[model samples]
Target: MGGGNTAEQAREVLMDAAEHLFVTRGYRASTMEVIAREAGYSRTAIYRQFANRDELVAAMVQRTTQRHMVSILSRIPAGAGPVDLLVESLVIVASELVSDPLLNTIADQTADGTIASLIANDSGLTELVKSTVETVVADGTPFRPGLHPNDLAQFIIATALSFLMKTVPAVTDPAVARSYIETFILPAILQESPEPRRVF
Candidate 1:
């Protein structure tokens, strides 16, 4: 409220309250007034930070996912090959998303297409993944000759996010998920390989 840092701290506090309400009361039912009350802020104060409930939710999602992804990416070993990086990322990211409480609440609202729209419109999420892909590719691993890092990053994001909104039978089994990535996903982005490399 006093300056940029104060306002940012206030926003984080609001987002923390919103996450609790959204997870416990469900995203569809957690209105702005409810969130404001939970955060111990007036409705007017909430509006000063976010234009609407949708905006607040989007900001929360971005913050939560960026933090989660950085943790996941850091767990991947440095200089990992393209296959290992992509495969481990897809498996681990998708698995964690399935188990997250807030994401589960969002997924439950998929009948209204909220989850789909969130994923489709989130350029921040895509850019984060793309930046990670570009950085990892600098390690001299051979991806497909004509592949663009952004394109590959998009594919991984799309695939990883699919599990967020729905139960994927194939991916429920880690081995099957690995097989799908190795068989279909890896070949699309990686250079010709007679066999998939086992990284775990």
Candidate 2:
């Protein structure tokens, strides 16, 4: 319908303006009026799309993180081993934080940087991680007993996101990053290690 299309388009335009301003000016400095002016629209238009600047910024961050995740994960091969796939998934996340244009821009501009919290908090991403776990372990593999699939997924996603925010040199090398992640995060749910558990 003409109504929805025009509204959706206007929303996208406003979001684009907000994203640029946020990247160039940081979250605190970017204002609703400034975003509307940059979008060449009235403040009324933004309010139609979003209740406030916080809502608009949250939406933009969610969209941007989703886009980045989809792009990075799409590159992994389908036939790879489950552990390999999971490790690579996290490695790609780390690599993107340091390299992806939008993420790099956000890191440079914000004081409390990282869109990871936004992504990790979103139900969509949680669902995505669960779905990925289901899909990857579909080949007769089982997660360790006492660990819910969703809980395992949440642990992996949270650890991966936290690691992504760090600037460690090990994460700079995709191969090394993958190895560390495999040894660190995957062992918990995978329970592949024979070593005795130390701490909870």
Candidate 3:
């Protein structure tokens, strides 16, 4: 194999090993020595690729978030009604946060202040969701008065994260969480009320 390919492979190996250790062992308890041993490399080799454990964890979080954005975008049904599409997008994000191993690890590690700061500084996910909403609004979808599409999109993302935090542990069934989002959030975003049907 080429030297560059070998180096790339080693980096992937280190990241995979670090992700597993960081998730299973907790970031504070998982030392570089342990990660090196897990990755089948010496401490020096690990340091060559990553300056420290924090950098390694940040890389893992970036990779995880990118994968998450792809997953959410893929699940958005084509030609869906605006409200339904928005709800599905929010649910996809919440589901990922609830189920994804890397995100779970980041949530765990966030207790130490590193992961929270990383997330607060990172707006990639927010921007992606905002762009999607802008597309819908540009396509002439209706939204409630006083709520700009971009602002509503940000609110949806924030609400999804909040719902994931509150309900993930207690609600094992996804339907329950979806119901809450649809019932509570959909009405707020709707632009029109249903017309009353006349009795025949």
Strongest candidate by TM-score:
1
**What lDDT is reached at residue 146 by model 1?**
63
**lDDT of all predictions:** 0.74, 0.67, 0.65
| Tens-digit lDDT string for candidate 3 (39-154) | 88889888888887767776676677667767766777777876777667666665546676666554555445746455444466556567767776753566766667657756
* Clashing residue pairs found in predicted model 1: none
Segments of candidate 3 deviating more than 4 angstroms: 1-11, 31-37, 40-55, 93-97, 109-117, 137-139, 144-154, 167-172, 187-200
Q: What's model 1's lDDT at 27? A: 82
lDDT tens per residue, model 2, 37-145: 8888877777878897546756775676677668767787877777667767788776666564445443433334445555566566677678767776654564565
Better of 2 and 3 by lDDT: 2
Clashes of 2: 0
lDDT of 1 by residue, 1-200 (tens): 32334678879989999899888888877888888888888889889999987778778877888888778779989877667877887777555667788767666564447665776567777787788888777645778776787887788777776756544665745676677677667777767744765423
TM-score against native, each model: 0.83, 0.75, 0.64
In candidate 3, which residue pairs get closer than 3 Å at backbone N, Cα or C atoms, i.e. clash?
Answer: none
Q: Kindly report which residue pairs in candidate 2 clash with one another.
A: none
Q: How many clashes (backbone N, Cα, C below 3 Å) per candidate?
A: 0, 0, 0
By lDDT, who's the top model here? Answer: 1
Of 1 and 2, the candidate ranking higher by TM-score: 1
